[model samples]
Target: MVRATMMSKQQIAELVEIARRDHTLWAALKDRELDQFNQDGSVKIPSISILVEDFVKERCGASHNYAIGSLIVALRLPIRQELGLPA
Candidate 1:
């Protein structure tokens, strides 16, 4: 049998906050990339996955699994919004 460690509500909230901040930064980076791409038909911005991994490593010093899991959970709202789903 495998045991799972669950984060407390406060921990989850903190993760969400981190995610939101990273998301905002990611959006700005993407917008910049879009503008650059429009201007020259090329993009040089790093991938969002790489950005999130770096952010989580720098901010939380947590494992890759934790970082990815938090990002997936955090991105749910934004993904839904992008898909035109109800919040």
Candidate 2:
């Protein structure tokens, strides 16, 4: 099996661009059900994150890997910037 490696900033940027253009994928990412909530009302995506990671990897022809924290940071920073929020 081909093990995955960390996705570079460029790769993550490309994935973000693709997600923006694809309505279905964008929706999936936005779906509340895909997120796991903790008892304190925070996300606990031990499994959910993996699912999203795998989904993105597959979409990008399995080129690179997105660790849980890296994926969250990569995706959130852009949205935060777009919303005029501090990143």
Candidate 3:
């Protein structure tokens, strides 16, 4: 199951902005090969590694919490656009 982290909305926004501009960052976030799920079949978000944490922090001065929320927000963009939903 994915761990939960507390983050400010502004931090999430900043991380999203950074991911949008950096393809490497974008790829890291978009990739979900390591995802786990709960007994209810809901996705269980995995924790971020130190390396990924550092990379994101380096770009947006955000912490793991920010990355957690930003990842959700970031991942949704492509899906939303693909489905013709507002992004």
RMSD of each: 6.0, 4.9, 7.4
When sorted by TM-score, best at the front, the candidate numbers are 2, 1, 3
TM-scores of all predicted structures: 0.45, 0.51, 0.41
Model 3 lowest lDDT segment of ten = 27-36
Query: Model 3: what TM-score?
Result: 0.41
User: 1-87 in candidate 1: lDDT tens per residue?
Assistant: 344345455765676566566667657534543343445766645554566557666766755335255554565556456556666
Better of 1 and 2 by lDDT: 2
Using lDDT as the measure, name the better of candidate 2 and candidate 3. Answer: 2
Residue 70, candidate 2: alpha-carbon lDDT: 65
Winning model by lDDT: 2
Extract clashing residue pairs from model 2.
Answer: none
Please provide, for model 2 over 6-44, each residue's C-alpha lDDT reduced to its tens digit, 9 standing for 90 to 100: 777786777778766777645555443334576799775
Candidate 1 segments whose C-alpha is farther than 4 A from its true place = 1-12, 22-26, 29-44, 62-67, 79-87
Give me the runs in candidate 2 sitting further than 4 Å from their true place: 1-4, 33-48, 60-68, 80-87
In every candidate, how many clashes are there? 0, 0, 1
